[model samples]
Target: MKKNQEIKKSLAEILELPKDIVLDIPKITMVGNLQLYIENHKGILEYSNTRIRINTKSGVLRVIGKNLLLKSIVVEEMVIVGEIHQVEFTD
Candidate 1:
């Protein structure tokens, strides 16, 4: 698996493609501490006012914050809005 990932990374670089898309990795975008955009997520594992767990290809993404809300959700992406204190990935 590790070898495959390294090959993918090399191909992405050589092809000048976005690594996240080529390697099937999650793309996380943050706007200060107020909003977050997660692309290429598998699903929402957990959700609450102060915590959220999202499943992705690489791992479980944990978001800890205040007044966290799922602003929007779609097949491939999700928008989160709140006081995002911490974002972590757990394998």
Candidate 2:
């Protein structure tokens, strides 16, 4: 796995491509502290008022906030709206 990641990183640098796009990793976008957009997600692992966990190609994405709501969800992307406090990825 480490070798694969190293290869992908090198490829990304050589090709001048975004690593997330090249490696099929999740792209997370945050809007202020109220909303978040996650692209290239695999699925939702968990959801709740204060927390949400999403599965992606890279790892498990965890969203921590208050009044968390899954505004939209599809196969390729998801939009979360709330008072977002922290976002992290875990293996």
Candidate 3:
């Protein structure tokens, strides 16, 4: 496999996620601090600003915070910053 593909595979294995799930794309953008329906959304370990949750097909981006500011939001792109209180994901 190529380097990027290998990396993605490694991440999927590390995350214990199914390959299909790990490759799912986001449908919605900037629900909150979260990117919706993002499958291979790795590399986020610290979420002190705002809580975020994305949905399948990248349809929804849910964010929870005291005062949130979404700098930009698109169907598959988003940015959020603010005082975050809690973050969770729902199925």
Best by lDDT: 1
lDDT of 2 by residue, 1-91 (tens): 9899889999999999998888988898999999999999999989999989999988899999999998988888899999999998899
Models, CA RMSD each: 1.0, 1.2, 10.4
lDDT by residue for model 3 over 1-91, one digit each (tens)?
Answer: 4587678778998999876656554323334433332333322323434455544432344556755554555554555656555545544
Q: Name the runs in model 3 displaced over 4 angstroms.
A: 1-22, 25-54, 57-62
Q: How displaced is residue 67 in candidate 2, in Å?
A: 1.0
What lDDT would each prediction earn against the true structure? 0.96, 0.92, 0.50
**Candidate 1 lDDT (Cα, whole model)?**
0.96
TM for every model, in the order presented, reads 0.93, 0.91, 0.39
Q: Candidate order by TM-score, highest to lowest?
A: 1, 2, 3
The positional error of residue 32 in candidate 1, measured at the CA in angstroms, is: 0.4
Worst 10 residues of 2 by lDDT: 19-28
Q: What local lDDT does model 2 show for residue 15?
A: 91
The local distance difference test score of model 3 is 0.50
